[model samples]
Target chain A: MNKIFETPLYPYRRAPEQDEERIMRHKVVVVGAGPIGLAAAIDLARNDIPVLVIDDNDKVSFGSRAICFAKRPLEILDRLGAGDAMVEKGVEWELGRVFFGEREVYRFNLLPEAGHKRPAFINLQQYYFEEFLVRRLRELEAEGRPVEIRGRNKLAAIGAHEDHVTLEIDTPEGPYNLETEWLIAADGAGSPTRRMMGLDFVGKVFEDNFLIADVIMQADFPTERWFWFDPPFNRGQSALLHKQPDNVWRIDFQLGWDIDREHELKPENIDRRLRAMLGEDIRYELEWSSIYTFQCRRMETFRKGRVIFAGDSAHQVSPFGARGANSGLQDTDNLVWKLRLVIEGNAPESLLDSYDFERILAADENILNSTRSTDFITPKSEISRILRDAVLDLSAEHEFARPLVNSGRLSVPAVYDGSPLNTADALDGPAISRPGAPCPDAPLGEGFLLERLGDRFILLTIDADAPDEIEEDGITVTRLALSVRDDTTGALKRRYLGDEPSAVYLIRPDQHVAARRPSWNENLFRAAIRRATGKE
Target chain B: MTDLILTPNLDNADDFYATLLAAHEGLTKKESDALHARLILILANHIGDNKLLEQAIEAARKAG
Candidate 1:
């Protein structure tokens, strides 16, 4: 096993603020150095906004937790300069096969045929994911960007205020006080910041435990997601197996509610289960193991005054759909840009309300999907179990029953269909590329469309008349003029231009569509920019 | 918008009930419940339309 988590990647050191009597206020303080916190800090720092990320632990996450990273989050990470390394190190797989007993129920393809840049999903250990993010943060620091990570620095207490928040941080040296214009609570599901703030997650709690066993082994198994329901190895209990990088495989065995938690984690018990599945002749070494129960919950709102919650701190879903870290990255992607604008006074403070409006929608989507998956995997009632088993059995024989089998739908980026920032549809575009939806990627001659969009508010005109740039109020909407010829595969036409001969799209910094029209009209585009920036 | 077939599509209800009882013969309670679930799922899928299925479910409930 890789010793990536044994040593502290970011060790704690005494800072000048600890000695100085003057309390220094930072631009942003992200409480937790996990994926969400690091992404938020890196994005802010790259935008020239000073950000500090503090975590209780100094090492990478110990186990191979959260192995699946979806396409959209990968794209967001790519924008943060962390995607290439992760894609290179991560195992790319898309096929998920469901099994009932010894017979295969059905198989599903998670990705489309072509035209997209990223894969359906990549399986990398959470430690490696965090390590790559930390590496990206280091590069930003090397570039003299104002980003700092203080490990072993725990938030002892939080004082929320009308304008800003006061943070009492406990380091190995001692306790120090700092103020921040904005507080981003990226702590994990068991968030201390949330507890201090008296915020609670309100949702369903599943009454089942899953023993996650990550093992390093040499096997000729194809790289595919294998989920078994009522398998011979673990009859009546569901089991899930995923192939990760470095010959490591993640296997989860469902342990029913009310089991001896410590006894179930015994290596002998884990080995027996593994032997039953992989056979006694199988050679493997246990890497890591943990038991977790499913809880699909989220806070009422992500923002509370100057304290804005992100990732697990705000909402948490069962890990079945790989929505945990993936959604966390999107949270930072959606948050950092808006925060940067507000910090620079480019947008009103009220624009932050849109963050709550948008992320709450995404969180609800994640929670709903996760709860459904959990209910399917672990049937709550006898009738439900009978129906579920019927679906599984019928799925193996009939094509009609396949759709009813839910081994957890693959994670997809949430389209903010009802975002307040979105303008009413003016130009007829592909439904997938509608306003408030993430822009579908299409090859543009040599590079991808999202790479061109980057992190900017752009007026993307396709065979439409538009100026080089338009300055509405204080925000400048740069134009990226394109022709149908640039779409070699015609995916742009199918995705962006539906049946309309020409189209103009106002793309947000996060590459979500803000507004669109058939052709660029300055008056309408100006109003669009105003509405998009929450200026109206 | 096809409604549920509540007016008896089969000519003899006695034969249909006897056949259903015969299918449940020698089966345990759990097995009978499983068979019933499978039959219902099959019929529901064949019915296809959710509105029509909702009507059928409501009619079956009212018959109780």
Candidate 2:
């Protein structure tokens, strides 16, 4: 932690601006300053767009809420110039061990194949993460693009028209009215913003309740993903242990539906559960614990008129795979570029609709996959439980059951099939065929992998015969000058060209392949550019 | 051409095509052609579905 960041970064003490007066009018007003909202706000502000970020909290919350973050979000934070910061302040889990009853069934390294530029997953408490983001936002504020952080304020009402949105905000100062070109509701599930818009968040709410506790322990343990499928602690309880940055440990206990809600959550009851779970012989002190119920749902529409939804406002998924926060941050990354184009007038208001479509697809994917993962761990039915246990038991001996017991598919990235931006043919291989899938890390220069794609359009030409051409619309075209037969780049070669064909691939701003062709025709190339940039 | 057209969410393809056709009601071949090109790009931008976008563009071009 930096010395200056320990205190309030941006201290704006105004002498009560008038109620009817416009204190500030920004291009974008992001509601809530959590990870997702803060990501969107800082992204816009960093790019020289003034953003007013309002949150009702007096200061950053200091509890561990959303803890686990995946590789994609780490890449997103890397783009925001916080990759190194996260690495400095977080713990990375490279290995995982799964236990089925008292037996350890499987042990595997997450980054076994080894080609990605970033690690698989990092665990950083949401409290510390927000503090880091707020610090960075304050630094950007000093450089002219100020992110106005207004805490102790809640959104009262928001109405949008063709050109801009009118917001009636209730602040500690008083009821204030402001206007903005765009309004983003990054508020959490049970969002007041979504409710006000009359949008139905359709999904199922799971019946089981999970109790989480952060404890300080003096036990000898290794830094690995440790889980007990069916622990001896409680009859129907499952437990998870995570090694955080400090010596502290985060443990979660699955409490079945029949427990007394009021009596079970007390400190004494929690201590008893901990002693029963970890054994009384182990010395420990409880720091904090809370019981929570999780649900899985996606909003009907991510965008209603000019007001858009991000994070929990748009979707809610089971926290089994840590998809909830990661997906929200991804929504911000997908949205910021489209919002930038609209704000700069490079694209029409129609471009904003892509944010909704892309995010909704991602959210649906997350909800479905996370729900399945939860079911696998804590089966709702007796038969399902028996089947899951049988699979886990067989995983130790049978080859087929090993892969079945892995249940690691939730971590894989979702591929978008219906995206118009993808121009690859159906015959293209898995590496390059899918629409809106993140391009795999390819070797660039001597030691550099081509995974450091920022906010720009990239054109990769693997075929030596392809012409050297770059568009005036800020597209960067790089030539590989390698033969199409090269196995190292065979996927790119095959997708862009057939046998003995030229290798050319156009990558979008978000790193998905925009277009690929064996040999480039100038007219077709120009049309692809126009379509990609949403120009007719 | 109608000023506004109500379409299904772009998640589904059949709804998107229906909406495009509904928006182009009572237009000339040339008007429809230009409109189709513009609509393909617009809808492509909406769905982020590159395959659907490619399909829409090829269909519009073939129809013309």
Candidate 3:
């Protein structure tokens, strides 16, 4: 028996004039029940904000889409209370193997950073990730802050006003109207919401198609990422194998400049190709497969009028380094905290643009880095092949060269610069503060580290000498023991900020080191908080 | 320049290890530093012990 979440989708669409019987307007309407949308809804609803999420799909599909979840997304999920379930079901890849043809050029373990407390990366099916988020949404509904998930409710049109957004939704019952205080357009790469507003999605699209298939195999392959450049199965095609949760393994083959896409996707043709790639001796069962074209595009502006873009709706990138979904989710983390402020009436409309400016920068950085990685892996020219081969050959002998073989630099955290939210004081001078970047995770006693400094202003004071006072109304000050100095001081210097004499760093909830100064001067700290939260 | 012709063969673990080490020799100083961040996790995967993993990370950081 299938369990469907029952909600009054039809009755909730009563006309505005029928005041007595009309349904309450949602504070936020999130279109698309994908992982990012569901995550956005869960985060907001958990904070006691009313949210309504609509999707065209009726039920979750059992297929692989986004397979990689980096360390940062795990932390975001951990805060929303969905980390435990995901950790239980997801496959963790501690090691990766880079191959130069059949020869393994590099093999290294993804040791979790020494001071931090989480695995480097985990692999789970995209749909399962969405399902887990929906389940969390359901739990939030049980509490006072309810999230209404309207499945099969397609969005027909959107009318964004100065204060609210009017949505015309088409469901099985009929056409219904929904008025929301805020409209989140997470409808994906080809977004209708983005189209309605006439926003430009601009970037270069790569002329390449990747064939991906999930197969169950009886083989003694170790738990590691296996990548092959120019494998024997297909000429000018790269082969990739990633182990999914359970016994299923995802294999991706890059089709060359010209090939029959229609013919290659047929089950018998795909099976024959898989057998040819694996060899006649290998026994495997094909589960599913699909073809995807790579695109490196981002919106000219993430926000236009009252509508805002999230996830792939805002940016799209090649999957070589697995930055597409991970970066989109990071955008969600940045935008949600700001929206919370706006809906609660703490910030003005100008604060909303920070979400666009900061995330667009992040999107650009992530896509460019990922695209460079893809180019390096699948080089087209003879010169590029020689350069790539030379690096791989040398990486086999030197510890220094080994790191470049797999190109793990693509996974580094993004720093938000050039935004009104980022003050010059955040980056300047010799200060003991979390400035301009995520404050490196510090260890507290009893295995409980301060992972989240909260979504608003978090003031960390190391000096207990000045009577430990940071009584700003909205800012939270957590006093740490002398031991935090060991990690915080080292991290600050590494980030080029040098030592902190005053012994305090105020960190913004987006995890950027906002101000690295001593015991917060009441007026200065309050002003900075006002600026950061857009209260100014 | 003639490119190295090495086929992708998982059965030859010795070849795999040797090839990886050779690739490590090619990185510039700054590039090597960035790459070291991800190497600890890969090394830990090979060893299969969390404590050893921590030790490897600490040792790598200390040596660097």
Q: Which 10 consecutive positions of candidate 2 chain A have the poorest summed lDDT? A: A1-10
Residue ranges of candidate 3 with Cα displaced over 4 Å = A1-24, A205-207, A397-400, A406-410, A425-434, A464-502, B1-64
Q: Looking at model 1, give its docking quality level.
A: medium
Itemize residue pairs with steric clashes in candidate 1. none
lDDT of 1 by residue, B1-64 (tens): 6767777599898999999999999999999998899899998888899999888888889989
Task: Give lDDT tens digits, candidate 3, residues A154-204.
Answer: 889888788888888877667777788888888888888888777867876
Model 2, TM vs. native: 0.80
Q: Choose the strongest candidate by DockQ.
A: 1
The runs of at least 3 residues in candidate 1 whose Cα sits more than 4 Å from the true structure, single-residue gaps closed, are A108-111, B1-28
Q: Indicate which candidate wins on lDDT.
A: 1
| Tens digit per residue, CA lDDT, model 1, A346-405 | 898888888999988998888888889888988888889999999988887888888888
TM-score of every candidate: 0.96, 0.80, 0.80
Per-residue C-alpha lDDT of model 2 across residues A320-387, encoded as one tens digit per residue: 78887888888888788777777886666677776777777888888777777777777887656656
Candidate 2 share of real interface contacts: 0.00
User: How close to the true structure is residue B34 of candidate 2, measured as C-alpha lDDT?
Assistant: 49
